[model samples]
Target: MCWCGIAVSQILAVRVDLWNNGNLVQDIFLGEIKVPVKVLRNDSFQAWYLLQPRENGNKSSKTDDLGSLRLNICYTEDCVLPSEYYTSLRNLLLKSSDVQPVSASAAYILSEVCRDKYDAVLPLVRLFLHHHKLVPFVAAVAELDLKDTQEANTIFRGNSLATRCVDEMMKIVGKHYLKVTLKPVIDEICESPKPCEIDPIKLREGDNVEINMENLRYYVDKVFREIVRSSISCPTLMCDVFYSLRHLAAKRFPNDPHVQYSAVSSFVFLRFFAVAVVSPHTFHLRPHHPDAQTSRTLTLISKAIQTLGSWGSLTKSKLSSFKETFMCEFFKTFQEEKFTESVKKFLDDVSSTESKEPSGVSEPVHLKEGEMYKRAQGRTRIGKKNFKKRWFCLTSREFTYHKQQDKEPIFTIPIKNILAVEKLDESSFNKKNMFQVLHGEKPLYIQANNCVEASEWIEALCRVTRCNQKRLSFYHPSAFLNGNWLCCKATTESTEGCARCTADVPADTQIEIDGDRETERIYSLFTINRSKLQKLEEACGSIAVYQGPRKEPDDYSNFTIEDSVATFHTLQQIIDIVEKLNESHEKYQKKRSSSAKYGSEENPIVGKVS
Candidate 1:
């Protein structure tokens, strides 16, 4: 298939390098063959010949197939390389060796083009960086003028590639950029007793004296907060900043937990503050995340934090005063009160008026066959804010709600109808505890006494519905965790969605799903033993052969025939016996089915399978 839709030039010739005993013995002409002209750029073709080595004079039998052959396809002589700068640069980079200077020059020229052209070249630069090919990449970056420099920084500040390359650039260009931006902030934060002098080189190399630990901690926290506030889309930049801070801490006060923690805490708080401010309702703090930017950020942050821990003890000198009070208070916000649990019990008491009802009022119908799992008095919303009391009941077969005990049910929902159950924000609709059950287009909103009750009810509902349906709605793991729509199930009309979703495996595809442990053990043993048997035959010069009725002269060797059956004295007998049994069973099945004259559709078992 020609994926590129461009015509490729003809290949001039193919040269083979022959190697013997790990040494290149000779370069041979394997008969000149011309590659087809105007070939589709991305299409592939196959060519094969009898793989035989040439015999040496008086040493023909000594020639062996153990040597290696290397094939090279020549195209520069007959083929025209793409003329566009981008394509030209790609071609330059494609050369195996001795093209770094050419590639570098091409990159510099591309950078000198219009701003958009330079932007297009940025991805290629990033590719080179990703492969750790920094020499030519840095050479190209050095060609950028002041305007190009500012534009590149602006465009890629949030980009992971730029963030990653920035740290490397610091080593080359020195920390003039950081010094210019950070000096003012540091001066502002480090007030009385005079802030320690700032040295860009020392910071870049991870060595700097710390005259004021407290001042540095406050400075780190404030500066990082500003970085998060700037909303630079690149996590690499943010992470590199943390890395620099870690180095500073390491060089200033070795093995000091407080100093090391300042770096870690700064990174954590930067993320925490970023996520908190962006969408207060959700915990998604990842900026430009679920992509390369987020991945780069996480990698850098994790490495930076781990590096910090290695520099000093994580558990040292008891909890810091700031951690003891403020940290404890911060986490307390995420906890739920114990009152939610007791609210369910209290609601049950109030709704227990069935026992005092008049004798004439017949007891409400009970689901006698259904095993009841949960029963609670909850309130279902009527409109936007109307909270009407209802008794919710969950059984093995269905979910039911009643206006009250000893009364006809308001609604009965088959468990299978429940598509999904999700807990709603407690603050939404000014309700303390609420959840919604989605069944097709209609959503039933219900309020519990507290968050705990709402969560428990949602869990119970999902558990029952899952069992009844056996197949839940398909969703990405990330979507489920982030409380977002499944990429596959998104409301968008376009077919484009998550690319990672698995496609159905074709029947012909060689995919093997492993079986149970015992089956695996047996299979492994069978494979090992079969391999040994093959090696034994090769060593003794007695190859295995098939002796069945359909066997040909070319199929078997050193075989014997018995009274009615042909038998082969080889380890392949094990495989032949199994094949014969399978063939006979299949024939017997076909014969029986034909005699009965039963169509597959009439036979549920047969039709249900294939």
Candidate 2:
């Protein structure tokens, strides 16, 4: 679908056409755009151009006023660097689980730095989830977040890192669960469009409010039935995550047992299922975005689900969350206890990981794939000789790569046999941005075009294999060169690694996690944004000093700091640690430069030491 190697003078064009399924003129030419390529020195070009009418004299005149399409386009190109370049940053993030105060964690700091917290949250959640550190990490961060909140009703309300992580996790694991629960109903509603808008004032001409309410009731009933009945189909991973949240919430508020149910309901019902009801296209329940009327119908049904779910969380008989009068009256037709029991049963089924095996297997998911060069691994040779570009794919089940038109994989490594995936020493193959996958004593080396892809591949590979029982305690960070390991001085090829493994996942056949290294990663982030930290400290002081009536347009107003007193204390701890760490960082840098010229943090997460 992508075209390259075009001459500078060549033209780039886009022609829009209209297609009707059963019309006489099924295909009609609309407009065309022909632009001469320019600015060849730059990587991309972006601009809005006017659409010209069809050039042919054979065009019909019936569609003269079809209206123009509105679109905004942006073109960009990125040249990803070799993995060695980002080694310092990647290694820092791998240590995120260990950061104290949680806010100083690399993941949190990344969210702070980005314009949208969701952007940083997605990648960080995926990275940690793959490494078996998601639960503990999320617990620690959310615990700190809870401490900063004074309102019980609004707990975990914002799109904070913890909430966003859970959101992304559900999306990652619940693809099948969503399809099974909502696709059929969604397809029916979308295909057989209905006029279900119930607001009397907003109803269209000739629209009957009574008939619309009946239609609304029918759709809502169908969606609610699908949701409450399909609890068994809920994904195991999501259930596990929800179970963790339930326990965490109950422990936090032992006085109220309803908090336990509401915790799971807040996410499952409000965020996950109800949101899907409103936007089916986002969850892939629908192939295309719905029309305006369909969207309104979905929205009304979505609100009804939310209302019932919220009511299910409370013990009160009164249903009071409805914003519209008609909706309030309409919901009266249904019995509250009937749906409440259904909600309770669904929550119980999802949270129990007892009968069936937990759906924790992230297999068959396309973890990562791109075109990368692989060094020839042969029994006849002791070291690599040449590299060739091949399409590589790593999944939970296996790692495979193939050439174009290859029906089967040319090379594959079973996920179980993967012992250590570490950065390859540049000296071993005389090439930059290289990594090796160790299955047996003989490692398979691969080269990447740049540092980003190299880090991504290593992160993804390490994530899937974190739970493997046979992982190595120590691994050669580098490769064999001149009959000795490049990482260590040992001359024997079979000698153990000279450096200790840095990843938190254990090789001890037990699930062990290190949550302290995350702080070390945060120390680096603090260094990067030292000035911003200072400003935040000043804002904390200002908010503490003044407790007057509300004011806006100030440094303190820029943030959503819930418990300012608690946040101030946490910020002081972070600044103190950051300052102390920077002192040690300075001394370490001087020693490395003066005593050891070869040693560098540029090596991947594990295998290299300073």
Candidate 3:
């Protein structure tokens, strides 16, 4: 499965290094195998490459015989076409909001066809979210999942489409929230390792049992404090999703008092924060894997967090399910009520309406940041000034630029105030690679080092604010210079813009997903997994036709298909769409091949993913 995330060209190289029992590790270059990043780009490329001396090797001779190493590289790039290509599929998905029983929707049907519900859920969530239809679909599916629930404890416990969607949603929106909340302490614990093992059997000889318990207590307390204190930092979108889950869970299990807490905690704590604590590298909290000692320490902390997350279950020492008496006893030492109160409050904050700006949060998401020259907004019309090089930073909340990197920003523009961001006419600024940001009354003019940077900055600005309500409907393409709006030639600075804005995307939109790109990826998945989809189609037909006692399910039983008729109908439509898409792809491929020149070079990333 592929995710829309960052990718960099990196070729693995093996170098000689000393591994002294995981201690005193240093660069001891021995041999190397270099594979071009291009090879992995087209598809997974596996081959045996001979190791040779490093090009910069000063300590080795060419006569050195480095052994051969077998490399298996698996990677893929989805070449998404234009938005028009995906319109039909997008229309069907847009109607997901109105899909009765919700299970009949295109998005939900996609999940039923895939093995890992996540593969379908991730893109579906993003697509529905972009079109502002996620909450309804999630709520509908969750209600379906809740129908089979006999106990409050199991609410959202299953790896259903609804659950997976929520998981991906949190991971998408709460990425920055997690970093702000847990990364600091996670890094502290990793950089400074301390034994938190309270298990007597696991403790090494000469280790102070009391000291270990105290260390464990210290870490748990620190982590808990951060979790509770950072509640306001939760993303608004996550809050909405959690709020829906809590509301639905509570509604379904009206008699169960703690179901609401469990509904939110099941993901926020047990899944999100605690999981990140145990595996910091996976969450990008740390640069690399922690050492053995640090890893052990993190595991202990993660365990404590998970138990504490279940505030109600923590009341029963026996039900806490501690494997060892020491751990159970150590948990007794915890201020159980305080931790419980913290968890309760944190859940409340997250499920409630998030504040405008997260309080006490210094590190907002650094979206796209670099150094650029910004021309001063000179008060006098006649005075000329040179552009001042400044470090500009954009986050979800605001855009600010500083006199120096890592210093106080000289200017700040709240995301709401950004009316428009567009390229400035070269004639007005008399410079290439110039753009302007329309805010309150004045415009901020900036010059990038080059054209690509200029386009990137503009795209990022518009991308982040595309959904902003306050974004102007129109704007002056040229800068407002010498007391005139250059593009409109309007006398008043605040006159209505002469040109309409390109994007009216909601100002409150939290995530920016490429609808066409996600649609293309889903189409590709269907093309590759056509056989599995056909099997599902037949299974849906079988189940709908055979209204008898549920017999043994075939291959499609692996997927959750609650409504066979609805699923079958959706599957038929999807098959039709996929077939059409496949035909288009084939035609495009044929056209390209027909136009190919003799001995012409194609993609250098040789071979498809294997």
Candidate 4:
């Protein structure tokens, strides 16, 4: 197309030839063809050619003849349209007097408009507010606009148009949008202050505000109710909104008890609601604003404690009882640190009093009935014993000791002082078999089983038992029967030695024998000189020779006399006088029998009669 006055770049040029009924009419320059411009839904423009002959040369202009022309044109640059056109269209519709009929179109256009141009449409926003209409459409537009602006982060500082646009946007978008964008706007308002103009009535009435406030509250309440219904749903969003409201309430209605109470009560209810809905394992999302979150938490804790303090008021109602119970638990968890300290101090006090007085003290710290304390006695380690005895004063109610100190005073305090007793599991606590030391043909209890329960038995053993860690030969009693002695070498290897010659005979001269033809017998023999016996008595205070069968008699016909005889004495004179002579044997037997019966009903023996 050719234009006489327009710039060449703006004109469309095309070559064309007209034909009718297979006959060429003429070759002609299409000459400034009027192209039909299309306005795209996105507000972009495109031009298409439709040719017609000049009016001077036209035979007759007819509608049917206009269809014969076909022309091709190319754009000089990229054809993508700018976004400002849509924004302008939106602004026009927003300002138009007849916005109701085309409200959907305006919203759609605004949503499609460039985020940066939202401020440009602020004048149009005033029309919506004045009419008190298009709240939903405006809300959608605002949300879409917010998403765009936040994504692009176009600076809006000192721009009155932008500030009003965002505020209106938040009003339409409801509390969720307000919560998400509040921090940024609050920060802006705090820094600049000029852009955020508070409406006095809206702040005072809150959700009850007229027109736009009602719609805003509806959406906001919907979001909150859903949050209350399930803590798992949008917990972070709920926490943020509640936290923001807490701050906003304080700022908007400072010193107003009613508003403060309403805001804090709502937050407390929401917190408890969340706790009820969420599983114990789920971690509650805290508000992003640390200071606001801390204030909210403290407020809830205080409320819970106060509720617990007045629990007696709720006795008549089921809901009140439930509330009181929840409050008690909440208070307990909230005051955990304080409670722990108090308990520790109480235990310490009891322990100190109990340990102050020794067991033998004539003037004991006497406590009244049900009032008790722990007193620790100084440990006395007698002789060469390694362990010290421990004592404790336990009230009937006391379950277990909590203090871990090695020498803690025996707590004579009431049983209630014990918080918990840790009973070692069977897997952890080792069980030892009990054994008894027997005299000749007489059973004597030596050690009791269940050492954990029998401290006295363990103490006796600890006092008397001496452990020789050095590797020594432990001869099996059956080894002597076969006329052979089993000796463990220094390397701890078992080796057989002729019983008659082995030097490692047990000091006890009594031997237990078993046979099929007779009952089990205790054989006593004089195996040591009087000097050795005297030395043993001096070292251990007293020495005894024990001889007995360990169990009922069994078959012994298969037993062979293996010519086994352990060395009774090292010197020939002592062996001959003690082992070979009948007189020495009778004397030894009489002495043993007398000593066994001395402490019993039998007559006591005097000195050893030679």
lDDT scores in order: 0.34, 0.65, 0.73, 0.28
* Highest lDDT scorer: 3
RMSD after Cα superposition, model 1: 28.6
**lDDT accuracy of residue 593 in candidate 4:** 74
**What TM-scores do the predictions have?**
0.19, 0.54, 0.69, 0.13
Q: In model 1, where is the ten-residue run with the lowest total lDDT?
A: 501-510
Give per-residue CA lDDT, model 2, range 479-579, as digits (tens): 76666676776888889887645432211112233333333433445566677666665665666635554445475554545445655555565566566
Which model scores highest in TM-score? 3
- Candidate 3 at 201: error in angstroms? 0.8
Q: What ranges in model 2 sit over 4 Å off?
A: 1-88, 311-318, 356-610
- Model 1, 125-220: lDDT tens per residue? 344433335433432332221113232112222323223334333322222223333435533432222232233322334435354223334443
Cα lDDT tens digits, model 4, 1-610, are 2222122223342233332323231122333344323211123334444555543566676534444433333332111122332233334344433333221232222322223435324434443433333343333333322332321112122233323443443233223222332233233322332211123322333323244323323322333333222221112212233333334444455564334223333323333322321211112122211122222233333343223222122233523454445343323323333323332232222112122221223553322121111112221211213222333223222211223433444333332222111111122112132222111211111112344433333222211111111212222222111222222222322442212211111112112221111100000112322443223222222111223232222322211111112111111222233333345435655765767666443433332111
Ranking by lDDT: 3, 2, 1, 4
Q: Return the TM-score for candidate 2, rounded to 2 decimals.
A: 0.54
lDDT of residue 164 for candidate 4: 43
Residue-wise lDDT of candidate 3 within 1-610, one digit each (tens)? 1111122323342222111232322223344545555455544455766656544547556533765656444446566666887888888887875777677778777776676777888788888777667777878888888888898877777888778888887777667778878998888898787877677767798899899989989999999888877755565456767888899898998888889999999999888888889878677787555666787788888888888888486777444677766768888887767778778877877776433332334567667899998888754242336578999999868999999999998889988677788778887768889888988756898999998898778766865554345656678877666778778789887788787555332223246789888899889778777887788777777787556555576646576677788777887888898888888877866775678653456322334554
Scored against the true structure, residue 472 in model 2 reaches a CA lDDT of 75
